[model samples]
Target: MNAQAVRNYSNEFLNIGVDAAALGMSRSVVATTNDVNAVYWNPAGLVNIEDYQGSIMYASYFAGIANYNYAAFAMPIDKQSALGVSLIRFGVDDILNTTELIDSQGNIDFNRVSLFSAADYALTVSYAKNLIFKDLYFGVNAKVVRRTIGKFANSWGFGFDAGIQYERDDWKFGLMVRDITTTFNIWNIDEDAFATIQGAIPGQNQELPETTEITKPKVQFGMARKFDIGRTFHLLTEVDLNLRFARTNDIISTGLGSIDPAIGFQLDYENFVFLRAGVGNFQKTTEFDGSKSLSVQPNFGVGFTYKGIQVDYALTNIGSIGNALFSNIFSVKIDYSFFRR
Candidate 1:
């Protein structure tokens, strides 16, 4: 068995993020996340939850060719601790499988074609606790990942995440480390199914591919603050710096690592109606004349809360400026406590 460790694009689907509100802010909620969605953004913020909460989100990518969905639930264990669970799915369905299109007689038949789906799934369990020190919290996550490509290949992966958050006089800071112990995926290929396609292409599909994949650690640092405007309006702002160990095309890159900075702001009226905007994913690109230029993604969102139900919508991009189509994401959050009589 040939084993290989993939350093780039391993478990890339997980990076798509969850929650319309977070995506709207270009994923800059590390320091300010406090609801069920915190399970994905920064688990440490889960300790701030006061009651049972559940959230669901859905988004279509690449002009509806791919679908992404997320759900999460969280509850306080006690005055000092909380627990959460989250699930994510990203897939492309109805893909035509042409490997079996040609039969023993080498005759082409449209009926021989079949449809399949390529999908990725992740399940995460999280725990958070308030520290003995005032205004400090810590959290950890254990996650399992599964991926499938029709009946030809499948993989299973496991990983861990840790986070910490501190607050002082209306100011918050947070740090989240994803895949802290390095995630590993073991793949199993169906040789029988793959053999049917060996001759489909002259040189391709000649051999089974690598079976092992490794995902390295990533770190994010965030800071947030809130200000009161007049009597009924409030404004919140947050900034996050995401760091990857390898050098890349981020705005700030070096041999040691690369940094991607994101900034998000939210304005609300009486905590009922909300508006948000963010900018991030800065990268250097080459123009037609060979001149380098910087590109960024900007996102906008709106939210409304009535009783204990919150609905949020965001317009975001899956690719860099002018390169990909924009997606509309929607999410709903429910506070179970609201139903109590």
Candidate 2:
């Protein structure tokens, strides 16, 4: 926590980002057959669903001003081609901004509230395609991000991710590289920077503050697989191996010299209902004290489909503070059959 801690108004959920159902019960939906939630988790899973399907989820968790919300829509292009789009918003509220200055008596004073609340948002476009043999599939996604920090300034950037999934039969395999070309620049950035925001000093020369920009990292490589138990039940599992070249030396970062690994799983019932769960770092030492390094207690979730719409929900234990409820993920998906002669 010491090395990877954000000091400003950053939306952590957008990065550690999870679908409403996944975030609940500790986020263990990786290996399950919930391709609907995979858009936010893995884009390759898009081709697994029916044609012209879309999903939306709204969460009321984290208690205070923090929020997590997202939506995803995916459709098959012919038989081997598929496309999708998603939007995610994470942020906090009620922030107090003030300026420091010197009074006539040489005492320190502060300016009034400069701004109100701040947030971060990501707009993403993703596409996927299946190979001729029916065992290999590929996917890619592009994202535009916006971030605001108090009186400092706002920054914007563009990023890209690519992935591939291979499955011979009932056993399915998945793999992806996240943030392959993630690039961020401080909006209206300059060397003099925030120095102009300075005020008069007691008796010394004029002083100006210095501000800097930080760049997001490009995490690489994640692997997953799903097993079918005959026809009624199924099991899904995955492991992510992330390595960032510019992680510690990035512009906007904590400068930590380390790698993060995560593992998770899911269970499906009748292909229409799902019970999912997972465990990983980042938030592990958090909820479950003395839990497994990767276990972090347990993550569980369930989802069902009726008509053409699907709804997935999870259960998390709060223990005392009335239980910190996360969010729910919902979507309308379609799966079509196209067999060649």
| The candidate that achieves the highest TM-score relative to the unseen native structure | 1
The global Cα lDDT (0 to 1) of model 1 is 0.93
Residue by residue across 1-341, what tens digits does model 1's lDDT show?
67797675689898888888888888999999998999999999999998999999999999999999999999999989999999999999999999878888989988989999999999999999999997999999999999999998999999999999999998999999999999999999998887877867668748688899999899999999999999999999999999999888899999998999999999999999999999999988888999999999999999999999999999997766656999999999999878874
What are the TM-scores, per candidate, against the unseen true structure?
0.97, 0.68
Off by over 4 Å in 1: none
Give the per-residue Cα lDDT of candidate 2 at 221.
Answer: 48
lDDT against the true structure, per candidate, is 0.93, 0.55
268 Cα displacement, candidate 2 (Å): 3.1
* Candidate 2: Cα lDDT at 290: 48
Record all residue pairs in model 1 with backbone atoms less than 3 Å apart, i.e. clashing.
none
